[model samples]
Target chain A: MNRLFTSLAVIILLTQTWIALRLPKGFYQDSFLLPVLLIALLAAAYLMSRLTQLADRGKFWQRPCQLAVPALFGLMILLVWEAIVRGYDVPLVLMPEPSRVLVTLSNNLPLLWADFQQTYLKAVLAGYLMGCGLGFVTAKLVVRSPFLQKGLLPLGNFMASIPIIGIAPIMVMWFGFDWQSKAAVVVVMTFFPMLINTVAGLRSVDPLHADLMHTYAAGKGQIFFKNQLPQAMPFIFNALKLNSTLALIGAIVAEFFGTPIVGMGFRISAQVGRMNMDMVWATIFVAALAGSLSYGALALLERRVTFWHPSVRREH
Target chain B: MKPQLKSLTQTQGFAVLTLVLGILVIWYIAALLMNGNQMINMLERTGQSWTYTQVLQGAYSIQRPPLPVPHQVAMELYQSVLNQAVTSRRSLVYHSMITLESTLLGFALGSLLGILIAVGIVHNRTLDASLMPWVIASQTVPILAIAPIVVVVLGSMNLTGVLPKAMISMYLSFFPVVIGMVKGLRSSDKLHSELMMTYNASRQQFFWKLRWFSAQPYLFASLKIAISAALVGAIVAELPTGAQGGLGARLLSGSYYGQTVQIWAALVMSALLGWALITLVGMAERLVLRRRGLTR
Candidate 1:
């Protein structure tokens, strides 16, 4: 059944693509093939569902099958998008085709690379490190005092909920229109989340474990290192993962306020004004890749650091 | 009297007041130091020697200082919010209302879409496998990077003002809801499912009676996050579009011509707006949970 479904899906996909490509101009107004295309699309979806069902049964193929399922789904979405845009003659400004976006990305690799380096390498990296370091240290210091904790925790929670990105303009004014200002914005954006999470993580140590350590006559330092710090790893990693995306966003948005030249946000806003939707998309592609890569990297690190975490450890 | 004083000292409100006061004092000092440099420069350009007290006063009251003092910002905020009519372009109330409109609209739409998607994912194995990964992946993209494109694209299509901005908000606010709702819907116990099976409950019955109730806390938590994200989205959407009637536009215009006081006022307004929105969500959560007798 699975084999039959796969072959049927592939055939339907090929036939639909061929027919779509062969459709003449003005075919959208009145085309008998439209019903055929719709039927084929539904059939393709049904067959794909069957294939996914089989994928769940076979342990050996599960990983690759799970991966392929989403990839195939993404492909179908792109195919449909292309068809709709072409069939209805949607303007390029409104929505550029995935193919055109790819072409633009490939064509402007050098430019995109420069923007990536400027935004991601300099601003995001510097700001993430500094902001997270400050937050962790502050949390450590504040955690020692109940008074400070009571004061800072509520403040931090309030500040975190507010749009810290609004500080982009103020940072630009203070630090000037360079990568430094963007970095400043990122620092402010990332700091509170890290502080709040680190505090919560440190406070999450099991009281039973603490008592156990106390019975062992553990010193404050020993108790913290052996109990609290290790227990906080997952929450710290959560902050790290959250900050990874936030740092990118802060840098990009800050660039909107002011930047020298050649940054992801600059390219996006500039190309957007010129109605170069493809270039804007290509820039977005780069930003998305960078953001996901950082997030994925942090996630991998989290699994390694918190391997004992129930969420990390699999049944196997 | 002794007990009352001790209780007051131990209260969260007291802690907050202490911290806010501490922040204000620090802010004033920092403002003096920062703005003093410009004051000194101006004094030198005028070729006049200045006393420390005179420079202190000048720094505290200078228009367009690098950092405005708290009082200056407060005054500006007060004037903009209360002095002007709500319909006036200069009123912070008007700008905030515009932003709030988009934020709420997008939030509602996003919550509906997220709930629908969550329900679909829970019911259909194919959608669960295929769509869940993309939902997670969508968040990693720098959403602000696309704000300009979305604004312009929608603008070209004759969809301007709040709609384009709201679309961006919906894009942002939906992710947290989808993740939270999916988790909530799947959180029912195996024993509960077994009980439902013994009773021969239909899928819809299982969902409405068991799954939906189980998901309430998660939905409220995600809603809090979503509303704030929606506000951020509305603000950023305003930035790209250069719209004249939103808090984002206020920030941009303030930035353009060196109106530090205006920028600070707008920032404070947005923070207040976010706080109010989150409080409203909290209230709703409380009301809903209490009505259902689920609150502990």
Candidate 2:
């Protein structure tokens, strides 16, 4: 069955390429090229399935081949996109081809690098560290006080509910249009998650463990450092992972409202006004990469720090 | 560690005192940081030493040098909602309503689409293979990038107004639902499926009797996230089109005119709307779960 699928996909790909080349000059002018390309692409997919099946064996090669399927699918999408845009003479202003976006990315590497530095390195990292650090410390304080638990949690909830867009302008007003304002927005975006998660994590130590500490007559600080903090690592890491994504989003979106001439959000919105869709896509590509990589790194750190947690143990 | 019952009160009291002192010191430092110009102007306006009210007013005022006072925002919020006509184009209430309409519409459409796609993926291996990765990749394309394209395409086709914005909302909102619903629908145990098979139940019957019921919590969780995402999408859609109504447009105008209070009010209103919508969905989830004896 797998062999059959691979052959079918290869046949489809060949037919798509053939038909794409065979089209008449004026035939490329019609909007129908999109539909034609889609059909041919489907055929190519079917032929590729057959080829995959033919190559399949119970070995390492098969595993890589399995991984390659999605990449192949992505390639087909880009091909179809390019073919349709070129064939139909689609205006670049509307939707630039993927190749153009890549070209733009390569050409403007330095500018993009500066934007990345301003938004990601400066604002996102600074804000995330401050917010998460403050949240962790405050959660410890709240754990010590029933009054604070009652008062601060609700206040935190309220602050979290404040829309980032609403707060961004005020932050710009307060902190100025430099990266500081964007960092402030990231702090606001990140603080609540960290606070809530830390509180939950601190509360999660087993009752038996607390009783054990009580029997030993351990001081409050001793019990917290030895018992509670380790137990809270998993939950703290969860917050960290969440904040990683939130910080990026907050910094970028906050930059949309006000910023100096540099930042990913500024470039994206500005490029769109200029009808430079390719540059916009390239900026987005960078943002997505940054978000995913940050998330991945956090997840890796979580695995290391929470190695004894049940979830990590089970995964291993 | 569990606190000794006797020491609990002392610990609690000490913690509260610490919190209060911390806040006070922070506030004092913040006040001290403000320059002589701001302090003198503040003192001259109030005709007194810097009082809490004056400081708060300074914090939240719409003018430069200080943020809008919370009370000033409260007053503006009051005027925007109570004094102005709810349907008047000039009112924040009207703009909120317009944005809310798109949000709800998009949320519903997106949820339906998400559930349908999830159903297909759950039941059909072919579709699971072909479509799931695409759905994941679709999210990688930033909504900001797509919103303008969607607006332009739909505008050229003369399908402007709420639908284009709603479509964009759906684009963002549906992915979560699809993911959550897929996980929920697949959550049914092997035994449950085997039991159904042993009873010779039809696919439709099995779905209605089992899969749909199993997916409720996941559906509700996704709905909470999706509704907020939908509202965000609606706002973003407005940004690209330069629409003169809706919360997005309100924010844009507020920024343009430097009406910080108006911007703050619109933002507060939208956040309230998002919270309200999520709470409503959560309440409905509770009701449904309670009816099913799933909630305590």
Candidate 3:
């Protein structure tokens, strides 16, 4: 305990000194001391992480500690990036610093918002719901029929193998240059995962459970709604989590083909062409935030829905 | 040595035939439905009233239907795959080969890098703490969004062809391997770890003998995923290059010319290539795992 506090004090002191006492004439001038300070900070982070991992394993109050480690790591990375770009005078066309990307993101908020709305709020969500819904229904329909199983299940297995690049162009042509085409591509991309997952989940019911239900004279509907759906929740959520990312990917890639001149994908490709690399990075930052948030949201929902699942129970 | 043909029961054969016929019928119906507007436009242009038979006949065999009929795509595919030499630039096979060149190279490099990173993460606590979150964060930035940036920036450096495309593939292919490997290397239970400790095995020895062995199934599964991802990455990489010899470029050109049939042909080609590559990986996985008597 004493050692931990002492180490923490030293870290805080070093960081405070590094921030408070700065001596640099030109912002672009190379600073040897910056790398030295960063190295010291990195070592402190390493020690801090080791101590936390040893002492704290998911204690609720240590949440701040858990957050701090990654935040520090990210901060150090950004600083290094800023340093290299400034010191070496890397061209804007090649790579923009993190600060530049943030500035661009903040300045072009309306544009980013419009692009986000077009891609995520419209195409991605609609396609995700439709694709997963249709796939779930299809899985339900095929569950009892061996014929359907043999037919569609193999097709589902082949689904991931279909490159979206090929599908996107065709989808754009078929559905026209709008969100509908992108949604169609997302639908195509997401359909198979839901189908495969739901089918597997439905079929995964233990024969003993079926026998028990049979002894109770339960109908198929009762057996499914009462016994199977709960079990299938985890698989269903797995498909949802997988599809969330894919939906974003599908919509964005579909936009690259031909769009209404306002979408994440369209902006990215267009901005790159115009040599506005900061905007491109800004759009990418939007995409990253969107993708991660969607993924994280699905995961949280999965945890709630699949609380009974062994995988969930095993975590605690 | 082989499963007998008799294993494929009559019902299975019937189901297969039924599915093919069913898909064909659906394709024909879809073609009719999609071409309705076009057929009406054609008739209006020439001032001819639509006869049901005339429209139906034309719908199934249009020059450029939105969704090409199955037979039309099949015929187009046949011409490109069989009539055109594999060496010909027009051939889907030729484009597929070009894509595969980058895909394979990228998969190799990515797999190597992934394994090295996984090894580092597994052995070093500092790296595990620092790098793991960033690794996860990396994938959240959709590859499609960044692919254009990567291609253009790399292209500006006067780098061309397979290497640049391979880097895109590497960008995608490495993620799954790292995730899988991290999970796999840690999958050895407490009992096994204790057993290794009792034998006084070094870290290297334990990894090779136990952790690596335990990770076989995961490694193979991740390899399949990685290769498939690499194929997608390779295709996407072709997009910014413009008329470059890859399946993606072919699809782009076909789309530009409104060659729906040609686009469908390329789609089939990419689908088939991805399927074949995945199947080969799966076969290798099965063969290796089976040799070790671990089927399930």
Candidate 4:
């Protein structure tokens, strides 16, 4: 009954907003009713979400209902955001509306695409591969020697703890103001997480597997290749996923220090001087999209590679 | 992995020493390559020729190098951190305190927020279903990307210095705490939760007595990660502000003038700051865990 009442109230409030939004320009322009309409819409959305939450607890509708709750909440936020920005005549410089941001994103696709290519394709991918490759090889070496594990791991941690901001300018000095410098920053930022994870993963080899290998008189090479490496795949992928985020962050921030003509960070900082709020929002959107997609891809790849893991089994 | 007070192996000690020395050696080599070129050119300008020893010495002792050797950086750090009075603008300790103030403040605020959110999610099913994904998505949006916007927006509100930087620190620090805490809060066994239920325990009673206690390890683990992250955030915030103080400003100015030794010194100071904070948290963790009779 509460859900029904809330739903009814939401529909009524939304209709009122629609009416207010559609009212004659002279009536709507100078009136305070728009904020009132938006406020009501926001409240109704909130109550409706509470209703949806209660509704979603049922087993039969669990999946779709689970999706609905957040979707509704997000939609409500965007709706109110759009309405508030448009209604208040907020400065385009201060905060561009989502619609304007979308328009800028669509209109300037070529610019954003170039920035993405520069930041993601050039800097992130190369750095990620090199950093992870170094870390993996180093982990293999460290696994063979207890001394390396004890010593180099701490050393790597120390190197990693230094923020990318500190290393980025130094990288520009070393590699110059190209994607190479950004990539170098990404490499340094990513290297230690991969190292730490791979080392931990190496230790995750099952003792039973080791015992079985010993029974077969397996050499170190055979044991590592057949048992240890395979077992470490999940942890290695964990680092890869983590480093994806770090790599993007490092590349972008490095661009802020110095960059070629085109990159997300360059565009963001440059355009802000011109008060191009739409462009800034668009860049942030692109970054968020790239970050999420990279994480999602890594997750998907992890599932494929680690199908034997129990967590993977739970999916199907 | 635990190093005991006794039975210390010489190999382990030598391994660490050798690694440090290796890094120093490499730094010296790079310094010679990068810094020596300028020195060599200077010598040429003065109608003089130099050999390898001279280049090496010049690399180490040059007023400013593209890459400073370890000793040069160490000397600079000594001059800034030890010789300078603590109140001096150039003293690393003075700047570090500026950064640390914001880091600690942000960390405290963020941890409180994360814990509050985690507790809400634990108790309220709606929040778990709705808010958790948003929290995850929030972290995926690079904090660095929005940091400038945050700085500008908050700077316009007549708020400056610590609060804006603290906001960034809070952004970086809160995620781990929420994730760690949620996982920990949910880790209570079915039997244990059932026992609490059977005793007619209130939700508040169950949480404080059962859930929060169980969550201590996760909280501390997250806190360790979060506190170090807060320092990083504070430093990053300092970068865009062109501020008069803090390690980031020191680094920025050093780089602007090609004062690589000063940059390296500032870098070293920031590292020490991170190390000190992490160590403090570790000590606190040990004390709390010991008091709780939890040895992990």
The sequence of per-residue lDDT tens digits that candidate 3 reaches over residues A103-132 is: 999999999999999999999999999999
Q: Model 1 clash pairs?
A: none
lDDT by residue for model 2 (A82-138), tens: 666656657788777677889999999999999999999999999999999989998
- lDDT of candidate 4 vs native? 0.80
Total backbone clashes of candidate 3, pairs 3 or more residues apart or in separate chains: 0
lDDT per residue (tens digit) for residues B72-175 in model 4: 78888899989999999989999999999999999999999999999988787667767766676576666766777788778778888789999999998897
Top lDDT prediction, candidate number: 1
In order of the candidates, what TM-score does chain B achieve?
Answer: 0.91, 0.80, 0.90, 0.86
lDDT for each candidate structure: 0.83, 0.76, 0.79, 0.80
- Where model 1 places Cα greater than 4 Å from the true spot, the runs are A19-33, A140-144, A198-238, A301-316, B1-4, B45-48, B152-158, B184-215, B286-296
DockQ of 1: 0.47
Superposed Cα deviation of residue B13, candidate 1 (Å): 1.6
TM-score of each: 0.88, 0.77, 0.85, 0.85
Q: Which lDDT tens digits does candidate 3 get at residues B1-296?
A: 23564355435666667787888888778778889778989898999888888888888777878888878889999999999998999888899999999999999999999999999988876566667666756776778667666776778788777888899899888987887687677766667777899999999999998989877876886787789889988988887766369998887888888888898888888888888898899899999999788664
True contacts kept of each: 0.47, 0.20, 0.43, 0.34
**Model 4 alpha-carbon miss at residue A112, Å:** 0.3
Candidates by TM-score, descending order: 1, 3, 4, 2
- Rate residue B29 of model 3 by lDDT: 80
What is the lDDT for A73 in model 2? 69
Better of 1 and 4 by TM-score: 1
